[model samples]
Every structure is written in C-alpha cells, then in structure tokens.
Target: MASNIHYQRADYESGLDENSPLITGLTGRKPELKSRDGTASAMATFGLGFSIMWAQALIRWFASPTEFQPAPILGPDVIEPWRLVSLRIFEALSVGVLLAHIWYCVLVPAFPYLRNFKATDEPHQFTLDGRHVLGGLVALCADGFLNCHQYIFMWNANSINRGVWAKFLPFHNHLSSSRYGESLLWGPPMYVYFCAGFGILGCNMAKPLRKRFPDLSNAGIFTIIWCIEFVMDFVIENLAIRITHGYGYAKTYRPLTLFPEQVHQFPIYESVFVASLGLVFTAMRLKAYDTGRSPVEAGFEIWHPSLQGTVRTFAVIGFSAGAVLIFYHLPLNWLGVIGDCYADMPSYMKPGPVE
Candidate 1:
C-alpha cells in the first residue's frame, strides 16, 4: 500500500487538481492553472491543499483548550503530552512551506540573473526529489536557531502565545503567578501558521491543465480562500474557548499572550505573505505541471503532495517570532506607517505580581 501510494500516486493530476469551472467566472477564461518557470514537479497542485491542512492539524489537535474567562500560569503552557513535540512538528512542516515560498518567489524570478542555472529541464526539474526534503530541513535548522534570540530579552519584543522561540529556550517562570504564559498553544503564532500554510498551498498547488482547477491567476480565488480560513480558525478558537469553559481562553495577559494586541498581526502577516507569494508565483512563472526534466539533484522520490515525500515541517516558528519582532519595530520606528503592534512591559499586566 505504501509503495503504491508513494510511487504510483505521484501522477499528473488533471491540470494538477483543477476540476470543472465555467468561463463565466472572474477571469473570463477557461478553467486552467497557468504554467510557469519554477513549478514544483512532485506536488499535485490539488494535493498540496490537503498538505497545508495537514500542517495545521498538528497545531490544532495538540493545542491546549482555551478558557472563556481570563487565565494565567507560570512556566510554559503546554497542552499536556503534546508539548514540544507538536511545536517541533509544526516547525518542520512550516519550514517546508517556507522553502517552497522562497523558491517560487525568489529563485525562479531571479534565475535569469544567475549564470549557473537555467529554467528546470526534463524529469529532474519537474519531479520531486531529495532537494525538496533538504530545503525544508535546512530551513528548520536555520530558522529554529535564530529564534534563540528571544530567550535573552523576552520582554523587549512582540511575541506569540506559545511561540517557537520561547518553547525552544524553556521559558523561565520568575513570579509563577505573574509571568502568566502557556508554552504550547496560543493565538497569534497559530494564526500565522494557518496563513503560511494556506498561502503555500495556494501558491504551489495549482494545476497547469485547463479545467482541472480554477485559474491560479485569479486573485478572487485566493481572497475568498483566505477569508474562509480566517473565519474557520476564529470559529474553532471560539469553540475551544467554549469546550474548556473559561480555563482554555486567554483574556488578559500575564506571560501567556492573548488577543486584541496579538490579533492585529493576524491580518497583517497573512495579507503580506499571500500578496508576496502571489506576486512571486506569477512573476516567476511557476508551473503547476511538471517540467519532466533532470537536474543535478532530484527532488525526494516520495509521493507527498508537498515538495518532498516526507511531511517534515520546521520553518514557521522562526519566521513568526521574527516577523512580530521586526514588524513591531519597522512601523513604529522608521516607517511610522503603522501603529502599535506589541504589548508593553510585563509590569503592565495586572491581576498578578509585576517586576
């Protein structure tokens, strides 16, 4: 079963996953995924959507229940057994998406400038191989490591509920009551995860064949998709709040970051990420179909919808932390374009001991 699923499953789906679509739709063109330069060979554009959902499943399932009423805790808030395992898993999955994003957005578009490489040719260029897996893993290491910076000065930057960096460093609980925090699950970071996950899917999961899926070029599809995901996440979050009663929810802050402040980034990060990737996907001419070429190193010879056959993820954590940190500063200081995105010092949080 595994072999058949892995080998035979790696087939070219009808236009990479697009099904029936009417010309009456937005683009006023036939239902077809556009072909471009750096399209992923291994990914079944339609299958990629499932993979994005797969990444979120880990984070959502292991997530600690949120309480409707305000709550606080010392140390980190891990959802019991899930703990570091879920966080790390989420990281690896996100990393793969990140790598794919970079490739589509940066590499393919810039290929002309580079003397060494040309548009992918033959089976190696279009099909999946080890490079796909390595890219995600390598991103995991690089991204996983930089987040260490948050540990020393946790107070200075904007942060997520159970942000990857905080968990990696093992948050110190000074005033167990006051440091209020959960080490495993929270809103901001999780929201970012979905945004990235879906964004990645939308970017690379389109089929090149006409009528297999809707046209990837249509901005309306992505907009509707993004809106749907946000609503779904919000509803589920509320459900978690209801299910666990008040204990699962985050109202005020101790160390466990909550919404309003953290919530703003939800749209900001998602909008930017999706917009950037969309531009990259089109500009780079990423193909939804395989080039059916050969390159120096082939993609992982697995049948996963993602870049590689394995479901490794590890990139989003570093990006989430860094994104909050950087954006928090970028707007306030230099650009002065945006307003406040971060919370004040721990001393500001009430109901518990302050510094």
Candidate 2:
C-alpha cells in the first residue's frame, strides 16, 4: 500500500508542469529558478537605498556652498543648520531611491531576468511581477494609515513637530513645508525601500530556520521574523534619532523606552509594532508568489486578457495596502495614542517649531 501511494505521488508530480501556476499553487511548490542567497539580495537592496543617500549628499556637498555642521551633544532645541542639511540630504536620497525602485519595476517586464536579482527563486510572472510592486504600495498605504492618527493627535496637540526644516525644505510655506507634509511626500518611498530590503531579509532568515527545525510551524517562523524586525527597527531608529536629531519620541511611556528622559527618546513599542510592517510585507509577497494570486485578486481570471493586467495591478496594491493597514498601522496607531502619551513630559524632549 505504501509503495502504491509513493508511485501514485511520483506519477502525479511528473504529470504537472513545474512552471505552471496552477500546479505550483495546488501542490505547494516553489518555482524552479536560479537565485542568489536571500541575505545577499536583501543587503544589496538595502545598500542601494543608502547608496542613493551617499550619492546625493556627495553631490550636494560639492554643488552647494553648504558645509557639514557637527551635531551638538546636548541636542538642538530647534532645527539647527546641521540638522536641516541632514534632513534635506536624507529626504532627497529617499526620493531618489523611490524613483530608482520604480524604474526597476518598470524594467522588470522587459527584463524578466531581474527576478534573479531579487531575493526570491520564483519565476517571474508573465508580465510585471506584482510581488516587487507590492512592497512599496503597502508602505505607502501604511504611512497614510498611521499618519491619519498622528496628524489628528500628535501634530494637532504639538506633541510632535518636524523640527525646523519645515520652512526650509524646497516648497517654503506650502503644505509640503510641514514635517508631516514632508513625511507624506517622502516617507512612503523611504518605507518602501526599507520594507523591500528588510522584508526579503526576513524571508531569507526563515529558510535556514525551517531547514534546521522541520517541525517549526508558520507562527513560530513569523515570531522569529518579528523579533529580528524589532531589533532592526530599534537599531535604525536610535541611529537616526541620535545622529541627525531629526525627531524624537517625547510622549512615550517611560518604562517602555530607552533614554526616555533624553532628547533622543526611543520608544520600545515603536519598534515592537512597526517591525510588523516588514514581516507582513514579506508574508504577503511570499504568499502571493506561492499561490499565484493574491486574496484580493481572486476574481482576476474573469477579466479579459487586455484588462486583466490593469486589474491585477490594482489588486496587488489594494491587497498589500489593506494588509498593512490591518497588520501594522492599526496596532501601531492604538499604541501611539494610548501607550506613548504622558502629560508631564519634559519640555526639552518635546520638539520645538522648525524655525
């Protein structure tokens, strides 16, 4: 009986095309394709984002008369000259990375071999790969989702401000002048680059863990991803806060933070919830790739071939954005509103107007 079952399974497998989405999804099979190591791919993607920053900073340094100002130890109460330069450089770099990533997505269709360049071994879809585009869209949506609450409570109460760069960044005195406005402009793309890099890292990390412990369930893998993301967030956020003094967490619950009394207060929960952004983005992309259709794109087959491409594109964005809202933003917003506030918070820790 066992031999008969084994023979039947072999026969069934041999009959299905390895590249067919139907077989891949039904049998829980990953597409057979040459791929690079996940860690290396993740690092490359991440490095690209930072490379853009360095390139921009170098150009700005040479082109303009601006000089690099040393960051003050006590932390500036306002947007110091150095801080403004740092913010401008970083924001422009983020925009540059966004445009570059978008261009890569556009080129992927004409050059399907780009799949080999990403973290996955999965074969490219017939046209544009939804997985590649999903990361940025989700980040964009998640930014909007979290900002809605931050704008209402934090910005309105002046509990948080963009420091002094608001008036100085390109569009002076316009809606884009505010910190939130700048965030609205550049934050999504920054997050997209972040998620693309880290999300792939999480997926790559999971492969080894799964091999070592075959019994580990999906929940266990996700918990591991969450922990790694938390650590990454903690390290990155602290560096940004300490180095640039661009922004600080002023109203955080004291016990759940590092250096809560200092100007660069680091809220533990900020990392705790925000870490899920990459985790969810990775999971969604993997699931969609494995299943050959995202949950939101279920009825995609009914559309005509001409229109199906457009439908699929919207579906990918909608699915990913919705997932981010449910998984990352909802919980983060709740914690931000309830967990981060303290009425007696020190004035020095709070951000002053961007003069």
Candidate 3:
C-alpha cells in the first residue's frame, strides 16, 4: 500500500528512526520531538504532581484546623505601637529594594558588564546571559509560592499562631480563600532579594574555601552554601520575629526549639528546612549561568525559536516550584502538623481571631 507520509532529514538527526512504531503511529501530524535525556522532564512532572497533592492536603487541613490551640487566657497584644511603625518602615524599604532590582535587570542588557554584579557570579563565572535573569525571576516566583505554605502551616496552625501584618497591607486579614494572600504579596520579592545577596556571599566565600581545600567536591561546596543559608535564615527569621512581632512558632515543640524557655522561641528545624529552599534556588541559578540553559530547558530546542524563550521561562518556573515543594514545603509542614498545642502562650504571641 502506497502511503502519503513524509519524513525529514531532521527526524534522523533528532535520533528518531523513521520506521519506528512511535513515529509511524503519528500518521498525519508532525511528530513533536523531546530531548533524549528525560531526567529533567520526568522530575518536573513528578514534582508538579506531588505539589498539587501537597496543596490539596494543605487545603483540607486548613478547612478543619487542628493540632494547635489559642491561649485560653489572652494577655496583651505582643505587637506594640512602635513595632507597627517599624513594620511599616521595613515594608517601605522592601519596596525600594525591589525597585532597585528591577532597575538592575532593566540595565543589564545595555551595560553588559553589570552581569558580573549578579549574585551568582563566581570568580570563574560564565558570560552572563538572559537565562541568569530568567533563573532569578523564576526563583523569585517559586520562593513566593514556597513561602505561602507558612500561612497554612505556621500562621494558621493555631488561633494564637496567626501572622500580624501592618493594616496598610491589603491582604492582612484576607484568609477566606487560600490563606496565602499576605505571603504571596510579600514573600517573593523579600526572599529573592535576600537570596541573591546570599548567593553572592556563598560564591565569594567559596573562593577562600576552595583554595584552602583544593580537593573539595561540588557537593562539599553546596554543603557550605547550605550552612551559609541556614545561618542567614536563622538570624533574619529571629530578628523579624522579635522586631515586628509579625508571627511566632507558638505551637512548636519546646524541647526541639532554640530557646525552649522563651515565650517567642524559634524552632531549630525551621532554619534547616528553609535553608534548603535557598540552596536549591541558588544551585539552579548557578547551573543555568554555567550551562547557559536551565536543567528543565533541556528539551526546549524542539520548539520554534520565538516560542523557545517563553517555553523555557515556564519550564524554569515549574522546575523551581517543584523543587520548592519537595525541599521546603514538605519538611516544614510535616513538623508543623506534629507541633504541640501550647496553652501558656503570651497574649501578644496569641493571635485570637482571623480578623
């Protein structure tokens, strides 16, 4: 039987045999090809599926709301008038920092040298490309998604563990839908900016460490990066908690916390889990810059040149978001689920109602 099917030379180049059943099965349409290396695609698909299931589980948990309880006898509000004022000031500074980052991104093309200023620049850095900026943006959005889990697992765990933001913020008490409103607004910009700086610190610090111990592996270097992230996260989280009285680990198990006797103690595990988020993001950005393409961008060449940019962007976002789900959200939420219900919390630490 004579057939009308036609195959191009490119099909062979793409490693697809014209006589293969997979190719033959697609009779009329152009057979879209994917990368022969399927690791990134597989991981991304798995991560996305896991993330959806995790989100569904969290939604169910929020509907019932158990594990932690509000202090029976409320004291005074922990957030003082001065702390509110300070929080407003901090938010304003955050706005300025975000603006500066935007401006930097805008200028990077015109001033090509500015790429060296990006946080992921190692001494032996690759030439900065659009992928670096794209990686940062993806990390920013992914980190925001990662941070929103706190609203469900930390803030809303107990009536007393609620987050208290300045009233000026639009999403302050907006918890009717997903409890992520406030975190979605604040988390991405804040965490991305700080993580960039932390990446710079890690890169610079690595030079000395590498020279000191010439035989250090990439895993060893990342372990150091993880430690740096953990320490920085610890300091920043404690300061934010104490200064703004923004939120508390009211239901954290006392024996596992840093300051077990203190009313506003931090859980040691929080920093450990959160730091992994930064570590994954930093590794991704560094890899993107080094390889001139993200791990998830592997199969992107199959797309048209015009669409490749957009496709790669989404791929980076999906991969980073998946990494966040696996590394950050799972561990932190697991700990939150098993937290103790503390009844002796101070009034300030106990946020009474959702409003």
Candidate 4:
C-alpha cells in the first residue's frame, strides 16, 4: 500500500514531507471552486465603502468642519458679494461628489490587497479596472470646479471693489491674478489627457498581472500618484496661502474659498485624513506592481493609471506657484520695457474706474 502510494502520488509528493495530511479511509472528489465574478467584486467594494465611511465619519465628528469662504484681494469690485454664495454652493457640491465617487469606485477595488479586506480564495470574473480610470474623471471634475470658481472670484474681485486689495493684505491680489490663466490653460486639457493616456496603459498592464506579478492585483499605479498629489496639495496650498495672506489671516479666515480655513485652524485632523488616504493609494499601487516583474510589465502596470489620475493635479498647483514666484520678478524688460506695469499701465490695465 505504501509502495502504491509512493508510485501513484509521485507528482504530489516531490515536495511533500511528514507534515503532509494523512490519507482518509474513505475518499470523495473535492468540489470545484466557483469562478470569480461581478458579485464577488461588488461585495468587496461594499466592505471597502463601509470602512471608509466610518473612518471619514469619525474624523469629521472630532473636528468641526468649516464652510467655504472667498476673500478676493482685488476686493469687492472684482468679486461681487452676490456671487459668493452661489460659488460656494457650487464648490461644495462639486467637491463632495468628486470625493465620494473616488472613494466608492476607485479605492474599493484595492480592498482585497489590504490584509483587513482580504476574502477567501473565491474566484472573481470582473476586472474592476474601470474604477481606476473613473478616478481620473473625478480628479478632472475637481480641477474644473476649482478653476471656474477661481476665475469667477478673480474677475469679480478685480472689477468690483476699489480698495479691496489694500484691505486684505499686500500679495493676496497678485496671487489671485496669477492663478487665473494658468488654471484655464491647464484645467480642461488635463481631463482628456488623463483619461486617454491611462486608459491605454491600464489595458496593456492587466495581461501579465495574473502570472508574473499577481500582487499587482489591486488598484495599480494611478491611485498612488493621486495619493501623492493629495499630500502635495495640502502642504503647498497652506504655505502659499500664508505667504499671500499674512499669518494673522490664517486665524480668522472662514470658508469663502473652496478651501475652508476654519478646518485648518484646529487640531489638524483634516490634514491627517488627507495624508492617510494618499498613503493607502500608494500602498495599493505598489501591490499592483507585484514585486517588479519587468520594466515593460511594471510600466504597463503602474504608469498610465497613476499618471492620468495624479500628474495634472500636481502640475496645476505647481504652475500656480511658479506663476506667482516668477512673474513677480520681471516688470518690463523689452524694447519699450519700462517700470511697474501694474502702476504705470492705462486705466484698463490697472483695473478699477478712471481716476
């Protein structure tokens, strides 16, 4: 009997040891595993959603959330008071929807890679890759909302009030103006660039994941890039805000702008939450890379989704910062170059009514 077992079980015993299972007196065929399918994917998604919801709820509960407040340094002339309320409504709705969608669609797929969200070895049919691309759309929507709001705010602030600049602080008005055209040029184009570029990358990357790098099993690289962008935005924005508005302004500020200063004023809970999400995204991305299978495999795996989702985000903010720092230095240095254009230009260029 033992000889028969050795002969017949040669394939299974090549790597076996004493610890192997004992043979049963009676035997029966093991059942086949059901294939992976959409239902399994949806269940995984639901669990992820629940965890995120609870986490966000807990964070919000501890910190008193702030409303949006817009303070255009150009003053009332450029940013009309009447428009402020409407803009705030739009900003809030846009941000809420964008955030919710990202968490629901993109982040959920990554749950399986996380130890906490792991399921049994059930087979799954759904690709769930669409969620990754969907993330880019959410990000683009966020960019658009911010751009339109900023443009409207700048136009009104510059046109409406005469003394608004003097009332706010020194550099606030200047920063606002710099952000306008940059947002316009970069904002809309980003939507298309992200969706198209990453869409292609994701499709190609999925092929090798099953065999070469199964760990590259989750959300892939796009998610990670956006996570990085989230961190960069928080740090950079606050610093820029401080530089433009005096340190004093950071204290009393409410939410007219899409960002709520009140939220920033307290225990830093908001910052932590944002940072945590970024880290989670990054972790998922690495999992998608699956231990660096190959350059092309990694490229196909991580590059596009991360790029489409995050590159534009950082670029837009970076462009805004660059505009402020560089433009401030060069006044006029041409054939007819002269002194300060803001002070010397005609009434139209100067802004405000004729003196």
Candidate with top lDDT is 3
lDDT of 3 at 148: 31
For candidate 2, the 10 contiguous residues with the lowest summed lDDT are 152-161
- Which lDDT tens digits does candidate 1 get at residues 199-289? 3444444333223555544555445444555455556444433332211211222232234343111223323433443332222223323
- RMSD (CA, Å), each prediction: 20.0, 13.2, 11.9, 19.5
Put the candidates in lDDT order, highest first. Answer: 3, 2, 1, 4
Q: What's the residue-level lDDT of 69 in candidate 2?
A: 22
Please provide, for model 4 over 1-355, each residue's C-alpha lDDT reduced to its tens digit, 9 standing for 90 to 100. 6666544334454566554547642234222212221122332233344334434533442352221122223332232344444434433543554454444434554443432466645333112233333333333322212212112211222222122211122222333332211122222223322332323333344445435666753455344444544455456445522322211111211222233333223213223333433333333333445542111122222235645223323222222222212221111111012211111111121223311
Residue 135 lDDT, candidate 2, scale 0-100: 38
Query: What residue runs in model 1 are displaced by over 4 Å at the alpha carbon?
Result: 1-134, 141-288, 292-355
Provide the lDDT at 78 for model 2.
46
TM-score of 2: 0.57
lDDT of 1: 0.32
- Among all windows of 10 consecutive residues in model 4, the one with the lowest summed lDDT is 332-341
Off by over 4 Å in 3: 1-35, 38-78, 105-107, 110-186, 194-197, 261-263, 341-355
Candidate 2 C-alpha lDDT tens digits along 36-78: 1122223233334433433454455335332222111223334
The numbered model that scores best in TM-score is: 3
Candidate 1 at 159: error in angstroms?
15
Q: After best superposition, candidate 3 residue 92: deviation in angstroms?
A: 2.7
Steric clash count of candidate 3:
2
| TM-score, candidate number 3 | 0.61
- Which prediction has more favorable lDDT, 2 or 3? 3
